[model samples]
Target: MSELDAAVAAALSADGHLADLLPGYAPRPEQQEMAAAVADVINQEETLVVEAGTGTGKTLAYLLPALLAGRRTIISTGTRTLQDQLFHRDLPLARQAVNRPVRTALLKGRGNYLCLYRMERTLESGRLENRALADGLQQVRAWSGRTRSGDLAEAPAAASEPALVPRITSTADNCLGQECPLYSECFLMEARRRAQEAEVVVINHHLLMADWALREGGFGEVLPQADVYILDEAHQLPETAARFFGLSVSSRQLFDLARDIRLEQQREAGDAPGLSEQAARLERATADLRLVLGDGMRTAWRTLERPVGEAAEALAHALAEGIAALAPQAPRGKGLESCHRRANSLYQDLQRFLAEPDEGGQVGWVETRGQGFYLRLTPLDVSEQMAGQRARHGRAWVLTSATLAVDGQFGHFLERLGLDDARTLALDSPFDYPNHALLYLPASLPEPSHPDFAEAYLQEAQTVLEASRGRAFLLFTSHRALQTAADWLARRGHHQLLVQGAAPQQQLLDRFREAGDAVLLGTQSFWEGVDVRGPALSCVMIDRLPFGSPADPVLQARMEWMREQGRNPFATYQLPEAVIGLRQGVGRLIRDASDRGVLMLGDVRLVQRGYGRQFLHSLPPMPLTRDPAQVRAFFADQSSTSS
Candidate 1:
């Protein structure tokens, strides 16, 4: 082994320093093997794609190697929640265990930091319409003076007073950059400077993908190029990448532009009546466009109703009028000049959507959510763009997650990111899954296509809930199914039911743990990145095979693109994606060495369909049973042993 490889192995060994530092430490050969692989790639300056299963202590397995190699590294995670956990909890613990004094910095999107110039401008405008908003702004103003990092996450605004977030934070469209009077004291700039100097930087996939698409002028401020990149939760990277590698116009962007113009008019263009009137007209036009787009619609541009096309034309006219009025006010002040530039950019973006769909893999589509609508010109596939990112940055790369492989194969993931030549590794969890868990598939449920499928699944799940008591997670493939199940359970009033949209995710999770016997119903968001050990979460029920919605505009475009290439989309694309998703939802059970639980798949297709064998081959080695009596007996044995 090379020097760095040896160091990582020794640090994670049974008798190493990490043993004493970590409580309830359990040494597993799988973790050591994974760490050695990571270290070898870092030393060789190569790319490594790895999947380390649950209870493998993956955070430490990759973290120790990155620290020992002593290279400038960028550690990107799937979400801000993971970003904070890695930076605050994992990084500090690893540093103390290994005795390394590495310089570390945690960076997030620009919105997370407090912008001093924007806060001052908001105060000067005196636009607070309520006492709560004013009090929240005042709280941030007082906290800003003492905050060294100005993360806003660190500020005392009782969750940063979310209502004042837009008022206090700066966006790329409004920021004046080096021209601002407070350029030297800018929080975002200072954070970037620290990242440039630190040995290791923690960021999320959103910012990483944004930087890869550096020209859009979104949150695409390129981070300091690094010697190494370690992307944890790598399964989420492709979806995040798809979002950034597209061009779009949104109702949100149009409304925000109008609001900014009004603010700039109040400050610098007070004498220009035409400017403010045009801004008002732009907002009204945007509202009309959203109305015609209709709610719950996501389809290609050509398929939209005729009214939508007309509203887009009126919107274009209103936007042109806005640019005409703002052109004369461009010389008034920096803020006004920025607004003028933004109005022109927004107009150009909307023109792309209004025109015919462009060639070269570009798929024009529109989606309306609530009162907001988005028009996107997205590439059907981003493999070429993703390949370019790997070539541009990092001497060494490590992409890892719990669900990167399906049926012992990495072809689907590698082909998606154009990393076909990268070395791949899969490590099984050290926990004894065979003895600690059981897969309960009821033979009685109807097809997921049936109209009464939700009702049938819940009726069958009533017995499993009784066996495991009330601690269970009812995972659904669609929001409609989730609502149906929630309504049925709420009417029963048997257990403390917590629905996903009823509260914030973190709050719901916190309440679930404390309640110990509550049943939580959730959709896609609850499929992964959740951890609950012991009997508090003894059962997991999935209502259907988690497949990508055919209604998704992007997915539809991709399916069309695959057909043009003469490829079987279902076997190659959809099946693998669904397998990984099912694994993620099933992973919620049996988290620790002592943990025990049962997984109930509500869909009968797992056995009725031939492709079900592939999913079985991908999951852990847990005994499967179709009888409810076997499941009840397993839980009964556990309860008897505990008593």
Candidate 2:
């Protein structure tokens, strides 16, 4: 091994500092091997896509190499939980072990921090619609004085009233930049700063992708250039990159712009009555568009009412009028100047969103989410834009995740990221899956397409939950199926049913843990990132293969492109995506070495379909069984062992 390789290997070895720093830490060959590989890739200045399974200790494996290499690095994670863990705990331990002075910073999305300007403006305006928001605002006010970092997660009030978040935080479009009175004291600016002070930066995928998007747009990068970039949970990047790379003009943005314009008028341009009038006009136009585009599933933009265009035009005109009004008052104060800049920028975005060619590489669609509507144009294929990012960033990239491979191949992920020539490695999980877990594929169930499928799937879930004493995750492919299961379970009322939408996610999880035997039913969001170990979560039943919706406009567009290239969409696209998704859902079952659980595969397609082997081969080495008696015996053995 080279000197750096040897150094990394030694750091993670049996008698190394890692053993001294980390309690219960011992020599693990997988970790050492991964660390050496990471060191090699960083030294070579190339891209490496790796899959280190759940128990492989991938974080330390990469961190040791990153720290020891002495490269300016940016590590991005998929979830805030992992980001916080890495920044607060794991990175510190690794730094201590390696004895490296790596200055690290954690950068979250905008909403995580309290915007001082917005907080003060909101407080002065006193625009609380309800008592809860009023109380939450006061709480944030109290916490802001004490919070050194200004992350809202530290404030209990923001935790209770999440709706108050957008009111107090600032997004890229609304942030006042260096002109804000509190710019020097801005918490988000400190968190999202560049490379001079910090050697290593930890951020979530959203921010990383947003930075890439900004660079691609020629607007400049949000993050500083680094020698190496490590993306943990990298499987989530493709979709996130796609969204950021697209054009978005939402009802929320328009409404917020209007609200901010009104606030600035009252504060900086009190004599300009036309500014307030234009702001009200923009607000009304936004509401009218949301009404015309009424709540349903995502609709193709072309299919919306012509009045939708009219309302959007009205909004653009109002923004134009606001910009004209602010241009005169712009010299009055920083607030007026900021409002003028924002109106001009948003107007350009709305025009582009409206005029984006439908026949090009982008697919235009609109969806109403809750009280807001979003007009978006997503790229049909992100591979080219992702390639553009690679060309521009030009750094050594390490993308590691538990779900990056399908049937032990990296073709799907590499294609998605346009990293075909990049080196790939798939590491076996360090857990004893055969001894600790079982994959039970039930016999004689209807295919996911059949009308009787939902009922049959629930019956199987019920059986598994009963055998495991009702501690399980009933994961479904669709919210409709999840709702159906919830209604069915509610009607039966036998087991303690914790439905997804019935409460907040953390509350549901806490309840599940406390109840000890509650079955948590959830859809796509619950399939990944949820880790419940021990006997509290013993069974995980999945309703069907998580295939991308054929009705999805983006999926359809991609499929059309694939067909034009003489490829089968199912064979090349749908199957691999579904396989990776299934791997993620199954991975939720076995979170730790001592954690044992039964994974109930409800979709009969596993045995009947030709592509079933893809998913089965991609999964960890859990013993598969077809017999219900065998499944019952497995759970029985677990119960007896625990007793």
Candidate 3:
């Protein structure tokens, strides 16, 4: 037997703290093979893309190999939830089970650490909110005295309040950096130092991308080299990558920095000129931008240059004058210096866009989404950046998700990752779909584009929700449709409503579980990584096929780029993206083999449109039915049997 295989066998036979690793925790044949395959990849220094299906013990499969690889490994997860689980629960147990002497560390983004400098500034200034801010500061003061790691999660009631949280938090823009009084004891710097020496470092995707974006230099930088990198919950990478590579500077940031400066100066007895005037300048810039945007119902994105119309030009000039006035008066310290640098950089960026419009990159504006405004510039496609960086780093990169494959191939993913020489792998889920889930497509609904679409979709949803006895998640492709269905369901008043945005997502989920026979109305965020096992989630209702909005700036540019290359954007780009999104939505239904549920898609285009078959083929091969009664019958059978 190979050395890696022998090591795993020894660990499997050990007695340890891991509850899942006891004698009762026998691995299924497929799980064993997956674990062995993961080991082989690490030992041979080969890139792998293994899709360990849910319940295939993928976490253990990779964690064991990572420990056995006997090298510095960096494990990055797509979400904070999974990162916490791995560091707190999985990794500790895996270490004991394997009985290794490996040293490890958990490193989250800088925002997670208590910014002692900022906290002190807020406390001394006394410009913070009210009694709640006082109480929060008191907690931070007490916790800071005893805490070693400096991670904010150590504080009780930290995550509950965002307002109180931000008052004590520090950002790269406002950090004191090397000149700060607390530089020697800086939490962020300490975390990075620990990460560099530790054998294994745990981080999230955003931090990983931030490291890539900033490279190894600049404020709050990450450690440089790693032997292996494993990313869990890989499905969220595409959108996350898009967001990190995109650029947008908000007016709120300027306002916050000004507020911080005014407060800090008042406490420190230091005279900083132009603080009030700078704040006003930023406020005026915001107002000018708003006036240009107006309250128009329709919004359009213009190329950075190309005369943003006359009104946009006026606003752009106003912003330029205001920023220039404030740039000279910024604080002289390194922290404020960084802020100044960024401000000057943004000013130059705006000038370039205004003067040279087609500046050979992606630049667009999104609605400030509120009374505030936001103008942005982002790369058209991150594929080249991602692929080039990974290839240049010369590390084995593995991208795995249950939904990565489109039509039994990885071309879409390969193209996006810009990987020509990387290896690929795919694995099927172990669940028996024929018995566990049913793909129910309604025959009576009109086309999605029809005027009667919302009502027709809601009617089918009502039937399915009734059949499942309100143990259903009614997902909508658009927020408008979600609100419409929510209003209709509220009027009907048949089941308890646990809608999104009414409460925190986890709280809403908790209430949904508590109220077993209830309906949940959520949009895009609910489509993935939402686990409601057992009978709590017996049906999933998708209002329409998930597709990227054609008018979206980034997606539109990518589509145009693909078309220019003699490629069919719909077939090459849109279809695969939609398929992956659909799979994520549908996969939320059947989490475990014993957990049975019905999936209802209200969009009739799945049958009418030729591309619909491509989407359907990506889903689990479940028994398909167009009859609504048959869906009702399956639930009835489950109810009867349960009773």
Please give, for residues 468-505, the per-residue lDDT of candidate 2 as tens digits. Answer: 88888989888888889999888887568999888888
Task: Tell me each candidate's TM-score.
Answer: 0.97, 0.96, 0.91
Once fitted onto the true fold, the runs of candidate 3 whose alpha carbons sit more than 4 angstroms away are 9-23, 129-142, 154-160, 216-220, 264-272, 294-300, 303-339, 352-358
- Model 1 TM-score on a 0 to 1 scale: 0.97
In order, what lDDT does every prediction score? 0.87, 0.85, 0.74
Tens-digit per-residue lDDT, 1-643, candidate 3: 7898877755654342343456566545555666677777777766776665566667777788788878788888877777888899989888887777888888888888888887887677676567876887888888888989888877757433776666666776676677788889888889888899999888999988888777723544475488777877776776677667766555565556556545543444246555555545656655666655655222335632333355455545644654564455545455445455555655665555445433355645545555656556666677788776676553655556667788678888777766677677677778888888898998989988899988888888888888898999999888788888889999998658988889878888999888989889999889877888889899998988888887676777777777878989989888888888888888888887688889998888888999888888878889999998899899999898788
Candidate 3 residue pairs that clash: 305-357
Tell me, what's the RMSD of every candidate? Answer: 1.7, 1.8, 3.2
Sort every candidate by lDDT, greatest first.
1, 2, 3
Predicted candidate 1 versus true structure: per-residue lDDT over 79-131, tens digit per residue: 88889999999999888777879999999989999999989988888887798
In candidate 2, stretches whose alpha carbon ends up further than 4 angstroms from where it belongs are 159-162, 193-195
**Model 1 misplaced stretches (Cα beyond 4 Å):** 156-163, 215-220, 356-358
* Ten contiguous residues minimizing lDDT sum, candidate 3: 296-305
Comparing 2 and 3 on TM-score, the stronger one: 2
